[model samples]
Target: MTEPVRRRGRPPRAQQDAGPGMRERILDVAREEFAERGYDKASVRGIAKAAGVDPALVHHYFGTKEQVFAASIEMVLAPALEAPAALVDGPLDGAGERMTRFFFGVWDAPATRAPLLAIVRSALNNEVAAGVFRGLVASQLLARIAQRLDLPEGEAELRASLAAAQLVGTAMLRYVIKVEPLASADLEWVIARIAPVVQVHLTGP
Candidate 1:
């Protein structure tokens, strides 16, 4: 009998063994890769190699590098992203307070802070990562808030951008920089002081 021929193109054993959570595993590895390598340097092949799967599988799940970045952002910012739903039906006057509280709540939660901090740190130091992050915030977070505000196009964008500046600044000081007083202060106290600023930015003339 003739010897059997081996397959010409087969995945490595690692790829064949990926389990039900392969998508999540990809995201986890992608997060580290993006954090370490920034957006421009991180590659699908590298992420797949770290994730123990084929590059084809990464593409199969995420479609593109940008999509993978968006998914990683969504995973890190899920709480804040969902917080906007609370604004959908609430009084416009209180939107700022609600938004402020929601953000602080997410930041205050021990479970969510690590990934959030990692993203913020990476964005601060990496221009490519910063662009990806800034786009996500502008299109997803600020744009959503602007829509709910029902202001004119120009005014809404301005208001949302201002409010975002306040929140992002606060996060940078309190979490990333670990500034004195603000970093160690009580969560409710910080919310009280910052919410009004955010509220004015959102609704004040």
Candidate 2:
């Protein structure tokens, strides 16, 4: 029998043990790794070790540390990225309230908030993490919502950015900084106060 030749970069499958859940496990561990170490210190080897997989598998799945960090950011932001759906499914009349309520609802949920806190902390301090975070938020989340709005070419983006600023600033105080009154206030209470402003940003002149 002739000998089989292996590809240059690919590790042997036996060594990879890349079962169905392996990729997700690596990502979950990577999130915690980046959260703990920040972007500069987190490494493929460290992430692989944490996930009990080979470093090659991490590279194979995510390409590099930056890519891994980007994936982690997307995972945390997945909930928020669905904002356009709320805009599309309902009348534009209450779109601002829907958007506001949806944004906080994701933050208020315990399941999404934990990983979100980790990614947000990393983005706050690391330039690389922050860059990736900003790029994804603009392209994936805000751009989609902007497209859903009826506006002139450049104006939709501006409106969406304004609304995003409003929501993001409020979230920073309420969730990240835990400012006393705002952070402790009821979710609906915050929504009632903020949604009107967001509506003005989105649909007002």
Candidate 3:
């Protein structure tokens, strides 16, 4: 009998270590792709190719664009995401100060800003990211804040949204877009000014 065709050579080295690393590779590629192209124009295939993995792997790690977007922003979201409900339930006095503290606390961290800056830039220019950003605020920040308070129907949604618009704008000018005085001013100065507005939205008329 004709010798059986020689079996294919050993799997490529890239494939050799691919099993557990696919998730990390996908994240690395997705972060770069999202930063460069933004969410609207980014393709799973392109990201997967850049990462040297299959497009299906991207889906396997992150089910949808929304999930990928959220995952990417995980660092930036932590402070607000964790603080909303807790602060709202915490001591009522000095709520504005507490809120301000939390905002600066997150932004002040060097580790948080890099990923945050990427997400901020993406959200501004990318349509998909804009929607995902809105969704994150709605579900994670706004919803949580609203649930803890005695706000009227739909007020939490509105209030949280309004708070987001303000915070996002401030972040853009101060950190991401890096506009004039806002960017240069001391952190405390900026937070002091914005926190009241946020406090009003979160706590009062």
Candidate 4:
């Protein structure tokens, strides 16, 4: 009797079944793969193996490796993507504080921060990853928040981008670079100072 032909780089038969949340499962593994191996080295087969499914499954869910990487980017930025809600949730009087607080809230939590750090590292290291990160930040997160700002056509985007820059720069200094004073400072203390600036960006004439 002939033995079953095992395709090269495929996971075991027992691992072939894609159960519930398989797409998310694949993405989680893809993040780790990209985080560790980087964009150039990470492959569909490797992600699938780590995900306990076939390589075809990763392609099935995300289309291509780049697409998978984009999806992973979206996953890490999901919380920040929801910032528009914070804008609309209450009076514009407190929008800056609300937005600033919300931004750090996402970063302060360990669950989201780890993947975020991986993504930021990848973005800084690879142009492809950086492009994907930039596109998503502009289109999905910034554009949405800009619309909520209720400013004139071009100005809204400017305000949104500036506010985002402030938030992102602070995060980079505090979390990524671990710069002294800022890194060790209290979260509320940081937010107290930043929220006003964000409010100005969004609402000041």
List TM-scores for all candidates, in order.
0.82, 0.90, 0.77, 0.87
1-205 per-residue lDDT for model 1 (tens digits): 9956535444445655677798899999998888778677889899999987788788777878878887898888876776686664589889888888888788878878877877887777767667878888787788888887668899988998999899889988998899998999998899899999998988897
Where model 2 places Cα greater than 4 Å from the true spot, the runs are 1-9
TM-score of model number 4: 0.87
> How well is each residue in 81-196 modelled by candidate 4, as lDDT tens digits?
86666665688778788888888988999999988988888888889889999999998878877777676889999998999999999999999999999999999999999999
In angstroms, what RMSD does candidate 1 have relative to the true structure?
A: 3.6
Residue 44 CA displacement from its true place in model 3, Å: 1.9
**What's the lDDT of the predicted structure labeled candidate 1?**
0.82
Model 1: lowest-lDDT 10 consecutive positions: 5-14
lDDT of 3 by residue, 1-205 (tens): 8955533433344455578866766777777787777777778778868987656566666877668777767635766688767776785445566766776667767877766777877887877787777777777876776676576768767876777677777877788868997878988888788888877876776
* Runs of candidate 1 exceeding 4 Å displacement: 1-20, 35-45, 63-66
Which model scores highest in TM-score?
2
Find the candidate with the highest lDDT and give its number.
4
Give lDDT tens digits, candidate 2, residues 1-205: 9868867656568756667787888889998998788777889999989888778778888897989999888777876786566664687778789888888888899988878888788888888888998999899878877887899859999998999899989988989999999999999899999999999988898
Rank by TM-score, descending? 2, 4, 1, 3
Please give the clash total of every predicted structure, in order. 0, 0, 0, 0
- Considering lDDT, where higher is better, how would the candidates rank from best to worst? 4, 2, 1, 3
